[model samples]
Target: MEKVINETDDKIKQYNVCVSYFDTLQECSFSCCFPVNVKPPVIVSADILKFPRTEYICGENFALDGIEAKVCFSDNEFLLYNYGENEGLFSSDVTTLNKTGNNEVEIKIRNKYNNDGFKYILTVIVKENRLVSIDIGKNNEGDVYFRLGKQYTDKVFFDHFSVTKHFEYNKGMTHDIKNNVVFNFEKLQYLGNGSFTGVLYARYTENEKTYYGEYVCDASGNNRIILLTPLPVSLTTEKAESVNISNLAQKLKSANITYKVRYQDNTELTFTGDVFNNNTYSCNGVTYTINCNKNSIWLDWKADKMDCKETSLEAGKLYIEDFWYYGEEDLIKSVDFKNEKTLIFESENIIPEDLSSYFSATVEYITGCKITINGNQLNKSIDKENKLITVSYNGLKFQHSFSYSYSSNGD
Candidate 1:
């Protein structure tokens, strides 16, 4: 009897089998029962004899034809060879060369008889012989842009170019064979993030000496790329503290009290009693007003304003929010001329002092400018590195700082 089985690394599982033999004289069939073993395919040995050359230049074909591998597999045949999370991410395995940055391709072999397979991973890093210059600027549509120069600096030694793009929303596309000086893209993104990246295949030639190659580049906020219009910051209550309306009445100065309330529905209501930001209100967007009227209080609704002597208000969704004019508070972490949302800048010193438990503001420096908190001077030291001026007074901590840079032309 002949035994049939595939050698693999899986736990040995018995596969029942039947074998038959024909008798010439009697013309009858005789059968014998046996067991075969089945498991996952095993990679006995493998050597990548030839792989595509590393650091390929732009505008030049990145040949994958040289990817020759000597793989000893327990499988019936090699089934798949592709690159990236989805195939044809930057360039095709069967058709083109490497266009993106460092990338890898996977080779899979499967045996149909025993249903076993082996996988091999190979890497390729490509580069071009061009200097990369990057900066933050604007695009044609007045949006903030990240500029990546692909042979734009060395335009005199050049010809047409090629580019490749991989986006966060989907697998990227290759924009090869373009006769332009600068390859323009909306944005540049890092891997696994929701953004876009462009690869340039630039060709430079002059005096019978031409340099041909490609390189991948990312914008430098040190891997932090900023966009013109990003999504809004969502409101969260995990860190919120509820507030009481009666506490707001303490800030009033009149016997017949009045208050301007910003309720939870994002609507405003005026009552003659008291109003303050609820401790549980969001810490970033609520506004509070306390007014003592002689006999009537000015009340603001969703759209209209009115005068009221005494009115009862059932508060709903009441919260406190403190924010500058620009945008969210957390995003404006590092206070500078570039990160301001509300306070105005340019030759003016403004103190963002609040009567509440906490206060924030920007401290502009002009070499000899003095800073004071609660009628007292602050420390003489300035953190030039962070461009921030620090101040704390009467149990209140404040970070007030902004550093300025001269215009490119020293304006």
Candidate 2:
């Protein structure tokens, strides 16, 4: 004998059967089935953060920290809840997006059963910000301090990184509200001119970005000189023994501009060509010149860009005044001064012996202490008996005798 039961809709039914006992029953068997319904895992909320889009200031990079997540979207399939993201996963780990305005991303999580789950799509906005200014300063002891921002922090600040100077401006600087540190100038001050190449240095701070204006200036003592943006071009070789114009043309062919190079003279060559399709120009510098002839190519470099003719300056043995630099330091290249005739040395007490001693003490001192040096305007004379080194330039005369002095600093 066997009993069977089933339930549905809050109702039950039962039946009993005998095996091989009834006239029509030969054998019997039984089976049962049940139903169950389980819901899916729950998703709390999706967090989205909007980062500040701006340029990097002197000491400021894009803010890699400080992200506030907001519940913007969630999954529609499940009973959604609100739970903050895992602390370690969200903090200090922001995606460095490209220079675009909008970014979209997807995240995944797991439920108590470890079942894979997903949430609604999240969107992030990224903006374009480029570097505007870099300011370096020093305190009393020459410790460097730099702050980057779109607004100026203080006034009367001193810069000691390279040269320390007191700074003042007519109109205060401005900062972009939308971008925390995009500096917009209000009033620029005009600083005095530089001796070498006439490049001016101006000092000002707007927003958080510090401005050490170079190259130009305004009337209110603000520097107006803008820096040159770096070029995409680079020298292919360490030492360019020779330059092939045809090869250069093939290498750098963009738009209608092509580069051509040729040697003209041993010391002075001329080049008439274009690099980026600007104009056919000529250059006279230390290395070589690229001059284009009517029918052929010509590259030339002057042999004596810093050569002075042989002459004697002896004004009654008081020393011949031929050429003179204001200071005892070496000549500086590319400085435009109010007066080139007047030589000015920043350090008044510097002497030739001290300069030579410093050079000997430091192994790599050649690149330090940059000054405008021009040997072309100088006249040199040698006294065989006294072993004297005499030089005359710009109506000034200098003479010195060498004495062998050995120091423990060098062999």
> TM-scores, in order shown?
0.20, 0.23
Model 2, residue 375: what's the lDDT? 42
Candidate 2 has an lDDT of: 0.30
TM-score result, candidate 1: 0.20
Which stretches in model 2 have alpha-carbon errors above 4 Å?
1-85, 88-94, 112-115, 139-318, 321-411
Identify the candidate with maximal TM-score: 2
Candidate 2 colliding pairs, count: 58
* lDDT of candidates 1 onward, in order: 0.35, 0.30
Q: Write the per-residue lDDT of candidate 2 for residues 1-411, one digit (tens) a residue.
A: 353332222222234443433333655544543433333334456444543333332222234234334432233433222223333333222345554555553434333222434443445555434435543322334111111111232332222122222323211333322122222222133222200112324455455566453322334434322221111111111112243222332222233322232222212222223332332332322233333332222323322121111133101111111112112222222222122222222332322332321211111111122333344434444443443434443343332233222233422
Tens digit of per-residue lDDT, candidate 1, span 1-411: 455555544466887788889998998989998787676655555555655455444444544454544545556433323232223212333234336566565554333234344455666654543432222222122112222211124232122222333222212323332343343333445432222343334443334444444433334323232221121122212111232223222323332433344332243434433233431212122222323233222222221111111133212222222222112222122222122233222322323343121223333222112232332332222344554444432223334444433333432
List the RMSD of every prediction in angstroms: 28.3, 28.2
lDDT of 1: 0.35
Ten-residue stretch with the least lDDT total in model 1: 301-310
